[model samples]
Target: MKKPEVTEQPGGDPPSRRGRPPEPIGEDVGVAHRTWLEPVRDRLVASGLTLDELVCRSGYSKTRLSELLRGKGYYPGWEITYSVVKALDLPPWPLRRLWTAAAREADKNQGWIENRIRAVQPLGPELPPVAHLGLTQIMRGPYTAYARAFLQSENRAQRAVGETFDILWLTWDEAVAVPDTPRHAWQLLRARVMSRAAQQDGHPDLRQAAFATVAQAGIADLAERKTRIDTMADFFDAIARLPQDQMDVIVLRHLCGVRAEAVPGIVGLTPAMTHTLDHHARGALTGLYLRTGTTVTIDTLE
Candidate 1:
């Protein structure tokens, strides 16, 4: 067969001299695509597939794949990304999100003139744009984990995660417009999950579930175990009574496994403020446990 370059020549008019740079939009477009695809491609190649081998399996010409992996102006579409994902024998989960983000950046770069024109329109409030990426799937597990930690019920946690996704759907466009869309979605999900968990503090069903957890974990045979269970119940109740900020910091930092230093980024506070909240939250928990004559350490909470 002839060289693949002949089969996949980039379709566009000749490069016009915009008098700004040789390839004004090329770098941005290339970087967006390369950011995710390059790593995957390198991994596959290291596993033994050559460029020509990948081209044959994926049905994408070598020239096109090479340019895309190099972060050229032409970002791959979903079809191409899907084909590559299959060829690389990788899951479509994150690759699709990366491709969608890259495609959005590429489209924005190519349509700068149109965007500028749209910017001047006296349009009413803009609706959020729809995200084609698998952002929901990406966030589902983390959101569920967060809810489970905060709410302490698997069923409630799943429902809370679903609700978070529903809210994300409504604000999809706004979330996806940011440079780090996943991080934005995470912050939104965290806030929603925590809010829903907080609302459950007075819920009769949650109270019952807490008792159920204690009963399920503690048996009646041992007096010592029963006393520990009682203390555990008081611990959780005390946690529920804490303020929202303290509760959130405690849950995210300890339960969700978020780093202490990184908690501020998710909670939108300075490092010092995050530390202060953590200190206050621990003190509150300590005070609550002390009233019951049980010495509970912050280390035990973690």
Candidate 2:
């Protein structure tokens, strides 16, 4: 096909433009995330620091940091995002809100809020032990926290935590070398943890009957244990309904217990992009939990 050509306007005015038209609004799901990040990136550039200097200060890989500043990724975690803010000594609250808005925009594009799923929760088996004591010890706290956050039963959560360590031990050397940033170890552990959790749990679903039973019970029947299970199930159900990318951010960062700085690489994003996705996912969950008028404290991106 022949390409369109510029031509003189009527009355000898300037020629009409011939280049491709601008992209349609809303075509790019990442636009909002990028828009909010670009200004901070420009400020970073104007500050006259070398890439190595930025890397040294931020503890992010050169490539990843550069990509994030260049607005290349769609999701960045809170840790990385905050690191940038801290590195540059910028105000926190405003940028934090902008980061949250960006994630909201991205999530809206992904149709996360409206999508619903009915699923049967799957339980994963415990992972076998392996070597790499240093790393294993490091992962224990966060991994246990993640398991407790995700699995309803205390025993299952403990087993899932063990499984996370087992998977990491299996490939400890390879994981250690990845990105080699301060947060890399945590990221690697989180990925394996989430992967294992997914494998164990086939699907997460809302058991309305359980809730209904609770609703009809006497005040004495509302034990702390039962309340915890109900809350955990509601969280898991919300997670199951999230869009894939948003869900990944939630699982890896919140459930699997990866640091915000470590989240981008684990989830295949730049730091700023990871922040956006993390914010959106958490915001969604928070809103869902709030509908019941219960105050919830999920992990922050930072």
Candidate 3:
């Protein structure tokens, strides 16, 4: 009789399909969790390690691993996650940061997060200096300024930039592979900033940001201040309605006070494209203001 062929899982473990396949992760799972969880599931599938074998390798029971793989029940702490990640020979830092983000999204308290993190061994080596000095430090200023426009808190803006850098470090290889590294990085930064932005009508609500504008601050009379704010609110609402590229150009060039030459680099667009976006954005804002009969001009926003 011919012998049944046996396949080996990673780490020289024999494959065993004793347990049922992991359940599909539902939409109910937060995006942050799904970001890391989906990759883990892909890795598991690629590894050809059954749930029973994974339990042996990760030192967790089949039930626990199954729940984690499916993203069911309470969010699993970092300790179990680290074990599985190591068992699968996957890099931990990127997934660690992602897990931390998911934990915060889950409203897991800092103490709980810290305790869970401590239960695992210290993370592997620090991010290389090339990633830090070459890209992160250079982009930090503009990224933070852009983030501050939406977040309104210096600490929150800094945190968002820091998280963006962490993600960049983890995905540096893929970032470099792309046609435009800065554009890829900008998208990541934008997502992080937007995730924390105040929402209005399902978009980032920038009307409150008008209160912080120098135009609003210069007004002394309460009646005049209210009028300016109301006008600025309408202007900002129109800004929110602008197409995304044009909106980004207006925000960076006018709102964030970044130089025209710098705006192109930051948004990863050519100088000509950036200028066109600015012109078109200004024109759109002008049209909106004309329709609304507002006296405020786009130049005044500068």
Write model 3 residue lDDT over 234-300, tens digit each, in one string: 7887887788889888888788889899998898999999999999998888887788788787777
| Tens digit per residue, CA lDDT, model 1, 1-302 | 11112122358645432111111124454443654564564445444566777789989897776665555644455665666666765545445444555566566453642343344323334332345236565456656766786677799787656645544543344456677665566666666555555454462112322454446555667786666666665665666566766766776776567778767656556789779988998998887667767885556545
lDDT, model 1, position 3: 16
- For model 2, the superposed segments whose C-alpha errors exceed 4 Å read 1-132, 180-202, 205-235, 243-245, 248-274, 282-302
Better of 1 and 2 by TM-score: 1
Q: In model 2, where is the ten-residue run with the lowest total lDDT?
A: 114-123
Query: lDDT scores for all predictions?
Result: 0.57, 0.54, 0.82
* CA deviation > 4 Å runs, candidate 1: 1-141, 173-221
Worst 10 residues of 3 by lDDT: 1-10
What would the TM-scores of all predictions be?
Answer: 0.43, 0.34, 0.82
Provide the lDDT at 145 for model 2: 60
Write down the RMSD of candidate 3 (Cα, Å): 6.3
Off by over 4 Å in 3: 1-23, 39-57, 88-90, 214-216
Better by TM-score, candidate 3 or 1: 3
Error of 2 at 50 (Å): 50
Residue 118 lDDT, candidate 2, scale 0-100: 11
Which has the higher lDDT value, candidate number 2 or candidate number 3? Answer: 3
